[model samples]
Target: MSLNSNLARKVEVEIPLQSPSNVPEQSTGMVHRSISKKSLATRVEKMLMGIIMAIAFTLIAVSISLEINIASTNRALQDTKVSILNTTTINSNLQQEVQELSRYDRIYRFANKQGLKMNEANVRNVVK
Candidate 1:
């Protein structure tokens, strides 16, 4: 009955309990909690996943580029083949015409037309 009213009305402060985990968590928003600790294994796993995806994407792009180059090369080769065939046909035709124009009868006829006479004594057999 002798105690002061101020002592009885003094406010007491209570501390909140700490979390069990070694790292602390932060409340970011009303619905989300942010982690303060990032494990090494988790970071490494994410890095490895990103590297693998980048490599895969690069390989796919390279493969697609190679396919396009191959198609272009194939088309160029086909065009060259056609040109070669055409040129070869023209060469063969020219050779055939030369053969036709070089016959003994044709030569003799042209020679006679130019007022040239063949002398049997001066004729020599040629060997190839």
Candidate 2:
């Protein structure tokens, strides 16, 4: 047996590939699954957006109501302050009038005008 025999040389093996016409339809299931996943994701995103909008609207309503309440309370406080000041001013005026009316000299002049005579011996002092 000679080592230089051409017919006894080693041969390379080749694997055969399938052509487009011979290939099986395995991508149909994958396409259906991808479409379903996209639709499900879209629905979830829409639901989340609606929930966020609802929360924002609720917060806005609450803030508006709080502002109205604060405004009303401030108006009431201002009215109360004005009323207290007016009452104090009226009370001081009444006190001054009372003091003027209770003077002894003024009372004596009124008595003389009424033809009343003063008798010092019968004068009475009353204390309250």
Candidate 3:
């Protein structure tokens, strides 16, 4: 049994051993692949999408600007209407004053207070 064991040890020791550093290396060259290009229809579609986005943005901006302008115009119109109403009231008061001042009795009393003598022959009645 001892002799058989010694023969087994000798056989194990005689076998060859391989290390990682002693192994052969494979090729490290770059591989080539075919380059693909987009089709004309796909390019055109992308361009049209960009144009549509730009047009949409422009329309939104224009509508907002017009809305602001409309609001401003409405404010101005409201102010004008208020001014016209105030002027109309002032004009009505002035017309009432004119009518009072132009009354025949009022004028006659004023003339009497000023020591004016009435001349029936020279007096003339004016018609509007």
Best by TM-score: 2
Q: Taking the tens digit of each residue's C-alpha lDDT, what string does model 1 give over 1-128?
A: 55654555656899988777856765566233223234556788899999999999999999999999999999999999999999999999999999999999999999999999999999999999
Off by over 4 Å in 2: 1-30, 118-128
Compose the digit string of candidate 2's lDDT tens values, residues 1-128: 68777676677999898799887778888999999999999989999999999999999999999999999999999999999999999999999999999999999999999999999999999899
Ranking by TM-score: 2, 1, 3
Better of 1 and 2 by TM-score: 2
Cα lDDT, all candidates: 0.87, 0.94, 0.85
* Better-scoring candidate (lDDT), 1 or 2: 2
Give candidate 2's TM-score. Answer: 0.66
lDDT of 1 at 106: 100
Candidate 3 lDDT over 10-120, as tens digits, reads 334566788977997744442111112345567788899999999999999999999999999999999999999999999999999999999989999999999998999
Off by over 4 Å in 3: 1-42
